[model samples]
Target chain A: MEYRGAPQATLVDLLDRVLERGLVLDADIVICLAGVPLIGLRLRAALAGMETMTKYGLMQDWDREVRAGAQSLQKGAALLAGQAVQPGLH
Target chain B: MMEDRSQGQVQEQARPEGAGGEAGLYVYCIGPALGGGCCGVTGIEGREVDAVVHRGLSALVHPCPVQPYQTANLEVTASWVQAHHRVVEAAWKQWGTVLPLSFNTIIRPEGGLSAADALRMWLEHEEGALQAKLDALRGKAEYSFQVFWDPVVIGRQVAEASPDVKRLEEEVQSKPRGLAYMYRQRLEKLLREGMEARAAQECRELYGRVARCAERVHVSRPKEGQEGQVMLLNLSCLVSTGMVAALEAEADGLSGREGFSVRFVGPFPPYSFC
Candidate 1:
């Protein structure tokens, strides 16, 4: 196959996996900067789908809140329709 | 515990200054022994970089302040992440195969051990597992494939094919405005479900096609927030370095099909595999 020479990885993909996946060791010492350990902030909220974030155990709380909100919205719509709640969405 | 710390702050304070001027180690990757030619790659924040060898393994590292790289701002974080990957890429280019470490992996001296001693101790402890991973991944690389379809086009196709949806459309045209609204809602929901079912089938077919060239596959969830584009698959595959070309060719073939947008990337260190 004549390879079209496409660029293999981009910064988004690299950043997504670099800290989230890969071989990590537990024997790490903490570095304190201004009385706080200088461990980096992982901005996972800015990347990944809800499914991916949940798979990696990053955003379960947010996921729960979203689900709950959706459920309530559905219930409110059903009430507005003047109908008893159906067993499930059709 | 290591997995839990992935997103949390690494708050390890060094026991009161026992060794002055000692810097923490920022690790990039570990690999089998290699001949002495410096990679000359810079670490995050332009630190000097080199390797620390013990037994038969070499750890590519650079000395930095004991603190881990952290920034609330994303732009700076991106640069840090980019710099981290650059080192790994350089190591892979020079060393052939490396066991890549995740970003922000910093090891400081703990339990009365200096930073170098701590690293050496960990290397000794994990030597067997590390070596096995390294050997297994020697000639393999990770590739990413993403498949997307235009939702509008899919909805149109679903509308054309589903007789129920077509009947509803006619009912809406005939009914008064109030009742017609409910029919429209039903039709919209039906079309959405139809599109999802079609997408699921397409995803299975694409995965089967791509899996032919893969040694191992890791399926990731599609990122949210595409207004009209429906993602079908987001996956990473570990393939023999030799098969990367074939995978890209397959991706090209998939992209050529109507309404499908395929993105293929990599030859990267097998981050998912590791």
Candidate 2:
């Protein structure tokens, strides 16, 4: 509510990520959501619907999110690499 | 890069290189107010590069050809980075409020106007962040106090806290699996809590010492990855920058205990406030 602290988006999001549901894999999850408005709904449902949360289950979810982030990062990397070849895009 | 060929450096050369574009411009950062045109940096950099001064603010930028951005290695990229850094560094030193954008933001041909609309949203957000930090430390200069535990201190302290050492030799002689597991968990928690308590105690002590000398203090965690417990207690003192050394000396007096240490870095860009 008060804007006196650190920038809301960076700090609030980071703290929320740390204390609550924990960190999100940026690359995997957000890339798909970049053009889609559904990232929140999909991610929220997946997390809320988690059937069991044994340590292993927790790790599995972590892995899935990280894998998605990795995929997103790969896409960005490829785009950057493609930009390297395109004289016009430079 | 062609100059007026001072003393005929360009003219005297047997093979003159291609004329460099005096046409180039450097872009400092893009924020909302840049709709009109840049109000170039005036005296510091020797060039007349200006900001796109609009809405009572501006983005100091330079125009550049789009071709070089495609390079894979960081060649043309380096020049832009250096130029931007120069502006930012000067602005920080000169005491102007600026929101630094990450490197290499460019306007597509004729897209500067559209860029301003988006820029407005972003600049407003970052500007709010800047103003918050500014207000937080309005008259203050930052001070940092760090305390690192001497290995001897950590060992002695943890050794004193652990009740299991007696059990280590006497009751747990056989290393019972169940008890050992419980013992390790408790030990870890105790050790962590002990270290944290000491760190907290030091922060309070440091805060007390400097509260007299400073208008306000804002603490921050030491950056991660360093080995030492890097317990840093940051403070922003509203006194003139002239008081920095005295504050450091005062901090040094308080931090002089065996396991504690103190250092100060600033008159900086007011990053903590921002």
Candidate 3:
């Protein structure tokens, strides 16, 4: 039950605050980046390494695609290294 | 065309101050105005952090091109976000309370005004609202509470507690092979429904317990958990600094339960509450 202080807060925690929460202003005077897709995409890519994305059910298809690509690359490396490919490696 | 001309004029009038020629102010958070001095903290992209005061309120900001801080590079974007939080956290420490702005909140010049002037003007206009929020948030901070339940453990508990599930289990054991398969399917469905009901009940109880120790409660969508655990509740609580210990004790009580675990993090800058 001991709470983690701010310094111990994870990147996901920070993202939840800075990206999603915080005081919103009128769009007229502030550079409104709220709906910009590219930034969202990039932030998701950055968070792909974290468990928060999977926890939130975000980018699952993309995550599978990346994992599939990585497995193929690993197989290729194994072939080049003259090692028997493991069946369960996928 | 006449329409295009008017659109162009509008753009000209709203000419983004920081995007091209003039630098706009990227505001981190707002707080009670302190005497003129550097925040002694660096902000996004190592920009010098300072305050723009209007009446009783101050916005901690750094000058930047009016363009939003955007990048395809993950590392760069993460660094920027972390840096933004650092400045806000610093301000929270210095001011005791603040209204933190979201990332990439750049204030641009409008019409013929300078970026600073535009910021000051907006502050003047929003002074009462800003001061009220700051006052309300004084002596308070935000804490995140996530409750994760081990599905296997909870499922077992449900199976033991529900008469319908237990009757099905015994009936399945007594039936022929083919009949048992169908009965097993029904049992699974029944168990699943019971689990869902239990989850909702647990969440409601936990919410009530935490609310007692918080000034405000924000319920967020629960996320999936690792290791076959399911998140039962995701909450952000605005707690008086003095009540943090009580909140933690409540969380500890929940975590001590058989099938549940809790992630308690924060003393954050009341980001969710603001």
The sequence of per-residue lDDT tens digits that candidate 1 reaches over residues B182-218 is 9988988888677666766677677878888899888
lDDT of 3 by residue, A1-90 (tens): 323322267766777778888888765778775544335566665544534444446445445544543553443211111111111111
DockQ of 3: 0.18
lDDT of 1 at B75: 46
List the lowest-lDDT window of 10 residues for candidate 3 chain B.
Answer: B4-13
TM-score (second chain) of model 2: 0.51
TM-score of each: 0.76, 0.43, 0.80
What class would a CAPRI assessor give candidate 2's docking? incorrect
Poorest stretch of ten by lDDT in candidate 1 chain A:
A81-90
Lowest lDDT 10-residue stretch of candidate 3 chain A: A80-89
What is candidate 3's lDDT per residue for B96-171, written digit by digit as tens?
8999888888888888887788888899988888898999999999999888777677888999999999999988
| RMSD, candidate 2, Å | 17.7
Instruction: Candidate 1: give the clashing pairs.
Output: A8-B266, A30-B12
Off by over 4 Å in 3: A1-7, A33-38, A45-90, B1-19
- In candidate 3, residue B265 scores what lDDT? 87
How much TM-score does chain B earn in each model? 0.88, 0.51, 0.91
Give one digit per residue, the lDDT tens place, for model 2 in A1-90: 011121122221211111122111122211122223232233344443333332323334244443443453343222212112222111
